[model samples]
Target: MRALFNDRGRAALDAAQDFCTTDALAYGPLRSEDLTADGSSLGELMTGPVLGPLTVANTVGFTAPVAPVMIVHGVHDASVEIEQSRLLAQRWRAAGAVDITVREFDFGTELVPEFDHTATNVAAYPEVIGWIDRLVARA
Candidate 1:
């Protein structure tokens, strides 16, 4: 699910962090299973605004000017599924986004063939910071 709505994954984390009043949530690369849940949460948050008309525009339209988006997820992220990212990438491509890059890394729960989710294994700071730096510089 996190993969499906990579756009809001971080936002949900932010919300959760604020709501929890602590940094209990973790971030890192993700796996397919991790996405099923995390992706759903993020999607819900994003679509909530869209469907509830919380934003200026009520729907996802091509005319909306959006900046380039960068997503970084761990391949072994058990909290969110890796496939979610694939789905989102497809949607963004369909939406005519040229600079969207979803970077997948290897830092999360141990690789189990049939697992759905795993615990975060590493701090996703350096790489994430680098990506954000590049994006900001480009912007």
Candidate 2:
């Protein structure tokens, strides 16, 4: 993931900002501390004598997009707060993007019957696929 912050990967990210008729689907998306959240695996491992890349992969500074995006997260996820998704949506809307969707779910809402960081991806697949189908139809 650190490679995403390098010169070559940065160029790709810069180009993604100009999305044209594309769709984004994020499930239980976790944010790094740098992206204005509480948890970070890198932070935990990057201790003394284990230096690493300074740049982290996150959407903290991403600007508004030309295409629509959907972010799904669990309401009671212990590892990552749903607030992170809200913050991203707020930031994108503040930048003038209006099509960002942040979907939140609770336990017993799907086949898995539990909604957490890992559970969201599996439980939400049925609805998520339909969303992708709709997005494809629009395109």
Candidate 3:
């Protein structure tokens, strides 16, 4: 998360941006199925020797103190489940973060109408702007 990069805590951010973020790495090694589904070459690289070993939970854990985080994810996300955001929020709380929030959106196909894994930034702009205004005012 961008919040983790701030050295001066919440004051360092005018606002924070978060899209579909995964709380935990998916189980097991990368499979050909993942590549075909996502069409990402990066997925293959992530499973390679360089990034594969670093993909573990412990390696991906977030613990730094920073600005308030506003996470937005689609409820029916196929790439990363919404539960991952929930779990990440839990982890942030367990680690002593109090200014984190998660917002779920609905968008998808007819069969699974809420299954949108990718949403445009415009869809969340208003909320993001409001969040930034509030945080900036507080700062």
What are the runs in model 3 whose C-alpha is more than 4 Å off?
1-53, 111-115
Candidate 3: give the clashing pairs: none
**Candidate 3, position 29, lDDT:** 37
- Which of 1 and 2 is the better model by lDDT? 2
For model 2 the local lDDT of residue 50 reads: 34
Tens digits of per-residue lDDT, candidate 2, 32-123, equal 33331223344553441233433333336358987888888888766578898888888889999988867787774345333346787777
lDDT of 3 at 96: 83
Residue 128, model 2: Cα distance from true site in angstroms: 1.0
Number of clashes found in candidate 2? 0
lDDT: the better of candidates 1 and 3: 3
Best of the candidates, TM-score: 3
Backbone collisions counted per model: 25, 0, 0
By the TM-score metric, which is better: model 1 or model 2? 2
Whose lDDT is greatest here? 2
Q: Per-residue alpha-carbon lDDT of model 1 for 1-139, expressed as tens digits? A: 2334444444654566466322433443444234333434434555553434553264443342277666666676555677776677766778778877677776535455233232222344566678789878977
